[model samples]
Target: MKKITLWLAALCGGAIMLSGCNMLDKANGIILYGDEEKVLSSLKEEHKGQVEKDSLSVKLMDTDGKRLMIMDETSAQYLLEKELLQEVKDGRDTEALSSIPKLAEGEAFLFAKKEDSDIGFDSLPDQVNYEGNVIIGDGRAYADMFLVVADEDFTAFEAEAKTMGIIQYNKDPDGIGGFDVEREQLVKIEE
Candidate 1:
């Protein structure tokens, strides 16, 4: 009887562990690293000509309707000057988080304009939320801030943004474009 009970307890513990792992994966968007290529490709095909050349600043929101990342043209130019970013590269891979130049308070890594039809905001899942703001300046630009939830629940948040037509495709000089979730996750709190 003791042996049976110990085995049963072990099995239950294993099941719980597995369940927790699954939940963590879902929350973190932690797919296989190689899957990033596929996700990036899908975005490229979906968002073409959505980036604005005239815009000077860009922002990325977190899953909790909070600002998380920002980019401005001045920083982009600085990156180009330092050869951290190519003067001209495919936009899809150009705006990666890793490639962004060092940022200070109120600085951004990229810049673009929000499309007309794509205007609007949606709430993220209770687990994750994000919102972004961009500031266009004469010779430079910056992202103000991003709201973030720091939890996992991004599934429902993604769905709601999709329904509201907030998702966007980023474009650059090389004409490469990709689906980016910057604005879609933001719920238009007012009008």
Candidate 2:
């Protein structure tokens, strides 16, 4: 009976650890690594020889540690919702967290179809909430990736996106363009 009880406790502990791991993964948007360079390195490793070294571009980076957007000549922009972990894994330096850019206190990340157009919020899951001042991009460069502040957890929002479809730039607003949340709500990011 003693051995059996110990085994059960061990099983429960393992289960809890696994659950925590999954939660940590979900907290960050799509992927999380030490820093932007690590992120780029991981991408190169994942894609192997296909990714070019000089064509990478950063569309956006949330200094608050919530999101990141990068693009390469070979693929669409990658929107990464990310946070720097308290502990660095694999001997990576925690100091890299300082590299992320910052925004004004009340300002948060937002996506505009273009500098002149309205903010698109219709396709996101109804559960995701965002209300705050937005800081628009520089407009000098071509930006394709976008990330908006979400008041709620992203699991449901992300799940719904996968179930319906992830937002794409060129896709028309056919009830499917906005992360599949339904309805087409477009408001200007700034007044």
Instruction: State the lDDT of candidate 1 residue by residue for 1-191, as single tens digits.
Output: 99999999999889878543333211101111112344343333432333311121223454443333322335344323323222212321222122333434332222223212221335422222111122211111112232222222222223212111212223112322223322212110100
Supply the TM-score for candidate 1: 0.18
Off by over 4 Å in 1: 1-39, 46-65, 70-75, 78-191
Model number with the top TM-score: 2
State candidate 2's TM-score.
Answer: 0.20
In model 2, the number of clashes is 3
Worst 10 residues of 1 by lDDT: 25-34
Output the worst ten-in-a-row residue range by lDDT, candidate 2.
159-168
Q: Residue 98's C-alpha lDDT in candidate 1?
A: 27
